[model samples]
Target chain A: MSSTHIVSIYDEELKYLSRRISEMGGTAEQMVADSVRALVSADAALAQKVISEDVILDNAERQINEKAIVTIAKRQPMAADLREIMGTIRIAAELERVGDLGKNTAKRVIAVQSSGMPRKLARGLEHLAELALMQLKEVLDVFATRSVDKAKAIRERDDEIDAIYTSLFRELLTYMMEDPRNITPCTHLLFCAKNIERIGDHATNIAETIYYMATGSQPEGERPKDDTSTSVVTADVSEASE
Target chain B: MSSTHIVSIYDEELKYLSRRISEMGGTAEQMVADSVRALVSADAALAQKVISEDVILDNAERQINEKAIVTIAKRQPMAADLREIMGTIRIAAELERVGDLGKNTAKRVIAVQSSGMPRKLARGLEHLAELALMQLKEVLDVFATRSVDKAKAIRERDDEIDAIYTSLFRELLTYMMEDPRNITPCTHLLFCAKNIERIGDHATNIAETIYYMATGSQPEGERPKDDTSTSVVTADVSEASE
Candidate 1:
């Protein structure tokens, strides 16, 4: 094949990898939304569906790894090309974890349903999930477009999710304190809130990856974690702020 | 340079990555051991050290990413060679998380010590950390050697950690139930136990990566997570298992 043919083929491989991540990201975002919807409504079937469909995200991650590894072997892409492949692997893994987080939340839906629903918490969770899913969708687009500015902008929104998480945590703790029966279900919901917060972190990671792909450097410094209330333990008591 | 020289150079790069990982693993392992010691002894200074020293692990992970990315771009290795580099990135990330887990556990030492130490829980945490640290060390060796047999053997022990974790969960919950004052400290310790459990998961990920590097394929199915106790939410009522 001519050099142009070889270049075009390599380009196609890269394109295919990006498209897979976008699809995976879309699925992951949907999972986040659906998992919360399941939680809020106590919809067992939708919850189960999210749990079952995680394997699709798993398979997408596997394919991305295979393709990226093979592409590096075949094309020996340099500089930006290499970062793009690495970013793809990183983003796919993030999306896959996002799926797992959503699935875990879905599982919580079942647990809460079995115990009995705490209706007030559901509204808070839905609000938090909406913020997280929006971050996920925007970060994924940043990945696809290599938009560092957009990525940085998305990074700022992690705190919003964190702030919601903090408030919900305190509210859940009060509920548990008020009613012993609330303990088990609230414990489950506490973890679910953490799962959603983690999903937000994964989105932030994707944003950082976008920054890395565009600039050949990761975002400097730790992304601020503003949801301080649920910090189970840390050296700084300040991190336990409400 | 002759092809021989180039191959030798690539070999050196792989060796360097292996050595860096080993060093990082040792630091992570020590962090685990030290954190548990801090917990058991109520040594705030040691706990403080682990918390502050996490920046080292962070730096190690950054270096691993830089080295792996550059090597892939320059060496453009195929098959097992490519898998090795990818595995390094994955392992380094896992190790970094291990460090974070240890650091978090150390933080719990401070939290619990401030409240008052529950002596019995100390022994249990020590035992779990020992198991997890052992797994971390052995798995890092498996990664270096690409020993499929060793990796598979390590995967089995994750169940042991999970079992310990499960039992520990019950013990802590009992503690929380017994005294209202115990709730905050035990809650702190529960999250610490979870951090250790998660460290074990990272070891399992290394085992999985080792399997993939050896055979160019991931393990055929899900690694058994015998940690039925920490199933915060699940479909089965039985999952609130003994």
Candidate 2:
């Protein structure tokens, strides 16, 4: 083959890889939305649908990985092209985990359905999910556009999700402390919130990956983190003592 | 350079990749063990060390990833050589996540330390961590030996970790329900336990990767998963009302 024809074929393969990533990103985004919708509406069928659909992301990741490896072997892509292929692999892996987290939230629907979840708690969870979904969507967009600035913005906004999660963590604990009956439901909600928070973290990771892929270095300094729930001591013995 | 000379250099590169993976695995395993020990003994110092040491894994992952990409570009390795390089990248990512989970466990040390953890609860967590650590170590060994049978066995054993985590989850919920004072500590401990469980999941991921690398196909049948904690309901309103 002529050198021009060889380069063109490589370009086409790269484009196909990008398209696959976009499709995978779209599926992941839908799963996150539907999982939260199922949780808020107590829709087991929708939740089950979300759970079953996770395999799509799994299969997508596997295909993308195989394609990237084969492309490298065939084209021997170097420099920027090599970085893009590697970034695709990493981003696909992150999206797969995002899908997994969404499915996990869906799995909790059955448990949350059995218990009567309070509107306040359900609303809190919904809000967190919305934020995480927004972050996921934006990062996916960043991946498509290769916008380092937007990626940095998305990275910085992760603290917002973390802050919300920490507050919700405290709120759920308070509910659990207020009534023993709330423990089962609130515990599940806490985990649901946690899953959403982790989804946001994955989005942040994608953002960082995009930044690295574009700039050939990591983002400067650490991304700000505001999750202090780990060390929070909300229940005082004297306060809870009757 | 002669063809033999070029092939030998590629072999050396592959060996270096494997060595880096082993070292990264060793650090991840130690981080897991030390984090659990810190939690059990309330040793903030050890937890701090584990937290600080997580960067080593992070750096190792980046180095391994860059090295693999470069090796592929230079060597254009085919078939099994290509799969081995890809497998190394995937396993490195899993090990990095294992390290993250351990550091997260370490981060919980201060909160668990303040609550005066019950001996029984600590022992439960320690036991769970032991199983997870064992899984991690065994999977790393499987990676080195490329033993597909051992990898499959390790993959099958994940349910044991999940079962233990579920029982621990219920036990923690019961303790929280019994006394509001236990809420904060139990919540942190619950997350710590979750982290350990996730470490097991990562190990399982590594085993699957190693199996795929050896056989060029996934292990058959769905791996058994026993973590039903998501759907578990332990709080009975009637029982608690009295």
- Could you say which candidate leads in TM-score? 2
Runs with alpha carbons beyond 4 Å of true place in candidate 2:
A237-242, B235-242
Interface RMSD of each: 6.3, 1.7
The best candidate in terms of DockQ: 2
Q: Summing lDDT over every window of 10 consecutive residues in candidate 2 chain B, give the lowest-scoring window.
A: B233-242
Per-prediction DockQ? 0.38, 0.71
TM-score on 0 to 1 scale for chain A of candidate 2:
0.95
Q: List the global CA lDDT of all models.
A: 0.81, 0.87
In CAPRI terms, model 1 is classed as: acceptable
Compared with the true structure, what per-residue lDDT tens digits does model 2 show for residues A185-222?
A: 77788888888999888889899888888877789888
Q: Give me the runs in candidate 1 sitting further than 4 Å from their true place.
A: A230-242, B230-242
lDDT of 2 at A140: 83
For candidate 1, what's the TM-score of chain A, rounded to 2 decimals?
0.92
